[model samples]
Target: MKEYEQNQQKNKEHYEKVYANYNLNNILYWLNNLEGYLDFVTNYETSWSALYQNDFRNRIKGKKVLEMGCGDCNNAAIMAALGARVYANDIASTSGKIVEQLNGSFDFSHPIVFVEGDFLNNDLASGSFDFVIGKAFLHHLSLPVEREFLKETARLLKTDGEARFFEPAVNSKLLDELRWYIPIGNRPSKFRGEAFRKWKEEDPHPDRSFSSAHFKKAVNEFFEECLIKPVGTLDRFRNLIKNRKWNGRYAKWALKNEQKLPLFLNSKFARSQLIVGKLPLK
Candidate 1:
């Protein structure tokens, strides 16, 4: 327990530094300039809002939403804009300030409160939230921590509320093997070597890339009803078309077609998984 506490503190400190150094201006510049492949890579929050339009605009309206590890709270901002009362939680103190800055940029219809603390041991009331969500957060945790975090999420959510997460999956054995062969210098131009080195130095938790089967097993242990959707096969191939003038159009077409493919194909080769689970009503 002592060692765990120390490690958590270290993780907290790392994130604090990350948020402190975060450049919103630089990010906006990249978003505006990165035409096709890079734009697709960086715009996940926008994609998520579009992907679950019905839920965001209707089902979760006027709902109490808790976003775990909400980083800069871009998703929380979206939820707030859609009329959900959002509680955005993160380990970094600077996260709240960033969220505040983000809130200032938009005319949000509902409240968004930034809660700074560990999600596993926060003072947030149990059975309080209508929906819980996270993106790109689960894979950063160790298996034990993931289990504990899910248990805590279950505890905090209302009996009928659902938890949703978008996480990276180790779906392709071939792609996984190929990753081992690709030299660091061969990476995309956007990933500068110095920036990559700095990120590696500051990142306390590296990607553990969960497999679909293992993640399903873990979720089943905590939730009664769970659905895991695997989407995107050969999705990374879009990167190859970066030099083409019609890269954005090709990337968009690839994305649309990838989602139409059968789940079996996606499960074998998809680069990510969207996991949704509901707690049984008492």
Candidate 2:
């Protein structure tokens, strides 16, 4: 198989394992207390905060929204709860099961439709969505696959529609190289030789560019407007805090203040970014 195809299969296998015994109780609780949950995501969580910036949580209600690479269905359920006609696509069939469970339990204004299997093959009509979004999703794909997904995003949305993605950014090679030496969670430091190699072998992400410049250029090819917002520059440091509550508090503060840095510095230092692409070049 080609690289993209291999990556797709790897992702399918990886997420299936990750979501194999997934419980919906937490998701259900959040759906029940959606307002508070929305507030938390909007202000506290790095990925959701960036993706839902500019009053997106308010605007998505009663709109046709498609979520590409909808893993675990948390965001999909949240969007549906917010009154969006949500179409969620993922390679993993296990995600479809979560959608079924959510639809069965929640009284969404519009139930989320799980578009199973390859996203490119989905029979979704053209110009059907008001918005297309992927939360921390694009960086998992090979560059070729990422471009294909962008082209599909362009084809899937209305002329005035926008595609928003929350993705990891690696704009500074120095920072990125430093990051590899510091291990997090189960992944060992890159200098750990065989251990790191083994961890990398099982890592689902395809080796590819996650730079802001690369993402901007890729999206610009298909969309007339591309806006890349830096996020989590300081928030990335919250990892050093041992206290969970203190970490959350620091993240909220860091995300808010990080944007005040000069644009060039933010572009170089931000650990993550929000990509907004509009006006599809049809």
Candidate 3:
């Protein structure tokens, strides 16, 4: 418990520093423009559109939705627009303020309730929400805490409710080995050594990546039925071509076709996984 409390404080301070510099005005601009919104979704959160956009529009209408670690409240805003009563939670106070600002800017049918606190200890009522979702949230926890978090998620959901998440995955041993050889500045991806080191310095909890097997083990321990889909089999290749003139075309093609790749290939090499699970019907 002592370690957990320390970790919580560390995470809170880290995110406070991170969100202090966030660009709410820029995000608001994107939210106001249709093409820009689409671009933002495609570039930063493609999995949302690919995995849950249709379901959110179709099944989430008039349902109660809870989003943990809702950074910037983008997904929560979308859920509210789709007619779900949304509760968005994050450790950073800035996130709550940002959500409030978004609420003021947009005419959403249902207003989003923003809660700023540790999610595990928040004052939200249990067995009340119809759906629980998070993106890149679970990976921030240590394995034991992640298991506890999943159990808490079960406790918070309606008997018939469901949970979904989009998380980073470590699928390829070859790529993992190669990553060590790439220098921080020369690395192809945006998350480099300096930024990672800074994050670690602020937070004691291990924000580790997951493999398909790791995700499955954790989900199965809490839920009886689940589906895990690996995505972005060609993301490294796409990253290689990201800055070239044909980057847009290549990204479009990759996004369209990556999921269609064979299950084995995706499981071994995809950059992330989308996990969907439901509580066992008692």
Q: Highest TM-score: which candidate?
A: 2
Poorest 10 consecutive residues of model 3 by lDDT? 182-191
Identify the runs in model 3 with alpha carbons over 4 angstroms from their true place: 33-45, 49-54, 180-209, 242-245, 280-282
lDDT per model vs. reference: 0.70, 0.92, 0.75
lDDT value for model 3: 0.75
Query: How well is each residue in 164-252 modelled by candidate 3, as lDDT tens digits?
Result: 88887788878876754444342332246676556446544575658888888888887888888887677546655546657656766
Q: Each candidate's TM vs. the true structure? A: 0.79, 0.97, 0.85
Candidate 2 has what TM-score? 0.97
Per-candidate RMSD, Å: 5.2, 1.1, 3.4
Q: Between which residue pairs do clashes occur in model 2?
A: none
User: Which of the two, 1 or 2, has more TM-score?
Assistant: 2
Model 2 stretches astray by more than 4 angstroms: none
Best by lDDT: 2
